[model samples]
Target: MTKRFMTTGLSRRSVLAAALGGIAVPALATRPATAALAVGTAESYVPIAVGAGGGPAGSDRVHVLKVGPDTAHTVLVLVPGMFGAANDFRLLARDLVAQVPGVQVWAFDRREESLADRTGFTTTDPAAYYLDGHYRSLDPATSAFAGHWGLARTLCDLRAVVLAAAGGGRRRVVLGGHSWGATTAMAYAAWDFDGSPGYDQLSALVLMDGGVRGAFAGNGEPVEDSPEQVRERLAAIDGGAVFDLSLSAVGLGSRAESTQIWYQLAGWYAHRDPDGPSVLQPRMPDALRPPVPVTNAALLGVLVDSGFGWPNDISVHSGHLAVSGDVRGWVDTGITPISRVATAYAGGPEPAVWEWYWPARLSVDLDVADAYTDTDLTRSLGLRLFHSGGLDVPLFVFQTSYAQGTIESAAREVVASSRIPYAAYETDNGMNHLDPLFAAPERNTLTTSLPSFITGLR
Candidate 1:
């Protein structure tokens, strides 16, 4: 009811507070104080992992990030996308807490995160873990146990997080996620928890630019990954190549995930030393490197902002490199600050924002997706998506420009078949895959709409 998240007359806009050195947080921004509100939140992580024999040392103990007061009545549990960690939703969690008086956000790091080596992030120089390889990555051989980190294991562990959020049925819970995380939400809804349907435990669902459409929409034609194909992939994982930084399926090439850490380092450099010479540049191939020598922020802008000329679907409208600087500078688009993007990647000692060692099996199991978890094969694969069509919880879907087709179809099918109450909104401005989470507090569509959705639920 209170519009405290937005203010009318604010004139100064600055970036990053003087922390240990730098943090691209929008300090005293000219607009509403939404971006500034991101900082100073009480955040903590607690291990709530389930299942047996997970990868790495502590990979079995998945940590759920808890933001906001424990007294909040409603909890929105979020799962990150492919190769993602809980910190990915840090901005959104802070924003949600600011807007709603009674809501809390619970986000979790996936199982394979145990493979991410954050040892490099602690070094004095961000580039210590860069191309020269000062921080050696985990040997894929050591992570052979990830071969069993499939949807089944993930769901079982996530169920523990959800149950903790539920607080022994005392708190109302809403489930949600981004990209692959959103798809995981759908799978969880369809999933059968013991004998009970997954949807029975939640009050509502929030899908941000991710959904399940016609995964197996064909009559008799085979799905993307058959049972035999899944078996062969598992055999390969057993042979030692456990980490899956490959993203060839998106036509984006294997370079996508392989260079994901380059972003973590790049973001750190940008936030730590915005004006410093680009540490990420030297590590990049000649083709991907900026044509002209650039600064740390400029290199980050090049990687994520399409306006800077890199052509990829993951690009969002963060801002452009300042044209005047001889070494190039960054200008925040105001929609999502470039500094926020940098902070999201490499700001502090928080849990990793990117999962460098994404389990190959989770993606493999999803290739044979069952839209509603209504198939016998779905149970066999451990997906447990038992009955999505029967979902009775309120559905809130916010479609973005980057990935709308599948979300639209999925929203339509669920609303029609289940005849449940639902709300669907479209992104008018240029919003990308990652924008919904990082957009400025007031300008963020989710921050503005989610409170009403959560409160409106019956």
Candidate 2:
């Protein structure tokens, strides 16, 4: 899916009117009252500096936010989704700290620095010049992962935060993240700490609705060539010129023109009501079609084995090769194991759905059209890595009815086929793709489910 930024032209009022037409706003306010949790009298909330990290290649100085009390036993590190800042978790963090006293909450300011400053490129074109530059620079050795700000380097930073907060005391430190941040925490768990000092520090990990997939792995069925390849093919079609002649053909040149077109489309979808109660609600604006043609040509290029490429034949070691197999088999077998354990605490599915039609709004000013590409690549990578034994750790797969059908089905398939032991929970509430993290009151559905799984970890 192509990511576009929502422009001011697509105001909420105008979008709502167009999308909803005669429908009246539901009198039943969607917002639910905050759930009350028992704050133990023995624990106290303490004020502490919560550290934040810049996006890739960011600075060393953590953007510290004050949260919680020092006497709490659990420290939670919150990571945000693409284009999200530390404050996005404020409502959820406030509630979490209140329940688990002495909980030190920290979130990173990924956007504090310009994308250029962090990724080393500058342009305002929404065609993803930044990602093109980034992947081109990926080298196993001498990459940022080895540097102070690399992924492993960030793990060190996290360890420091936990130790300082503990102050010679042993406390439960949980690494939690939303979207990309959640993937980062998972990557940290997968990091090869053979040479890194102080590797065994993390007590637990929480993936708030994020997991490894896509480009993180190499084994999945072959996808259509990467987006960079698609751009190249398009360029070739235009007589070897690097510029996108398609834009010229469409008569969209200035940022304003693109913004206007994007806003109208995004606004409509963002405000549109679903035709019925189902897993797949229309999240995209009516104006936009799937960016790429959903044709045989396109499917051939992108459709591959969904299990991130874990071999279907289970002769290989239990790590990477074990998860590989028929996508349906994996999910089918895997779900049974988790269902056994989750049945005790599993609640009915709370299905909620959100369509951030203009996901690229924040990055559009910087001409970063590939804002969502990273996620796509990440999902691809995750499929391959997890299947190849890169992810052998205990995993708790949470499925909600609100997920896009394709994604939800894929999750179900993988869980059913897996041989390893894990837990699965199908929520009772209406939780959608974005609602798991973006919605405030419903966030507990995620936190509570996670702690229940982790607290049982050996």
Candidate 3:
């Protein structure tokens, strides 16, 4: 297997070669020398138990994809967004570890990832399994317990991972998140752990294109849910809303088509047949599917590219899917590479990162908890938040170009309200919500800036 690098204490020729080669010249020029170590790829996959959790097997453990060495002095612990998994951070983690040597990046997978239908991965005909609906998925009712895996549990679970990384405070830990994962980071900062606060465990916070909404962190859109609405929302799982929508888009589902299958189909096909005619495009809506017959790579780019006008803020500028010639091609926007996106979205083996069992209860909990603020209704609903004011960790917020800017605005308000110090803030108008995570290493803000950010804090 190809070895992955992370910051460790060992000295290696490749590390020096990589640095001398100026792979990340801009970042390495300023980063600490000790932060440049790396370990083998085999040591990265880690899973920690959640004790006796209420959810299904998915909630039994939290998967962590570690880059660098455990002996590193600094750690970057990342949380995945909605329906995201540990593998989602692979490219970003690899990039970050390469630039800054001594920092270990612990990218996490939600308990929900355990529910993904990995069976499809064993098949060579992925399209038959994922696209042609030749598969069987777990019964929704069997996953009912997942509805109880709310924010409180998520935070508590994250706390366990942080404590492990901290090793009794020997390592300085930084928490980062993308999309709803950003919300998770902020919530972790504001979370109350027994008497100690969650921020006490973190040196800094990193947010990418996400913010907490509702009465607490909403930039302008405050949640106006009445107590009754909150109650109804709390009962969502009971009403049979247990999983997030899968396939091309939300609201379209057949029993055989799980989100895992869709992701694997798109990602795998794009990787294997990037220049071939799209297989999934014909099934997608007119707005999302390429107007003309396009290549698989182009098809994947359109799913998140701004050119397609994917209204849900999932849009990014990875360049147009079709570059030239008669058919579509990948036009790199000098941001994210389509190959990297394919790797992230594609699922192959047992530990591949793709979340299929997203608990509707967590979404409910985030909304009802209302930005980590404790209220009478929230408390009555069994949430343990209401501690946003206690968060005082340094903040580093990154907002993509095409977003509404609400995430940054909301983070700013939180920084001000909680008196959190602003370590850094930037807006890359060149990127989209997902671009921040998948940007090319040489030009990525995550790789170029985060190492120094974490090291400086230490």
Please list the C-alpha lDDT of all candidates, in the order they appear.
Answer: 0.68, 0.33, 0.65
Tens-digit lDDT string for candidate 3 (317-426): 56564334566666665466677788777754545645666666676666665455777866775666656787777877777653456667767677777867665777
Query: What's the true lDDT of residue 404 in model 3?
Result: 54
Q: How well does candidate 1 match the true structure in TM-score terms?
A: 0.84
Candidate that beats the other on lDDT, 2 or 3, i.e. the better one: 3
Off-target runs (Cα >4 Å) in candidate 1 are: 1-39, 215-223, 226-235, 238-241, 247-258, 309-312
| Poorest 10 consecutive residues by lDDT, candidate 2 | 344-353
List where candidate 2 sits over 4 angstroms from the true fold.
Answer: 1-14, 19-21, 25-34, 37-58, 64-66, 111-169, 194-199, 214-421, 424-429, 438-444, 454-458
Q: Residue 272 in candidate 2 has what lDDT? A: 30
- Determine which window of 10 residues in candidate 1 has minimal summed lDDT: 1-10
Model 3, stretches more than 4 Å misplaced? 1-43, 57-59, 132-134, 213-225, 246-260, 279-292, 321-327, 350-353, 419-422
lDDT of 1 by residue, 30-60 (tens): 3354433645767887777567664545666
lDDT of 2 at 104: 64
The TM-score measured for candidate 3 stands at 0.82
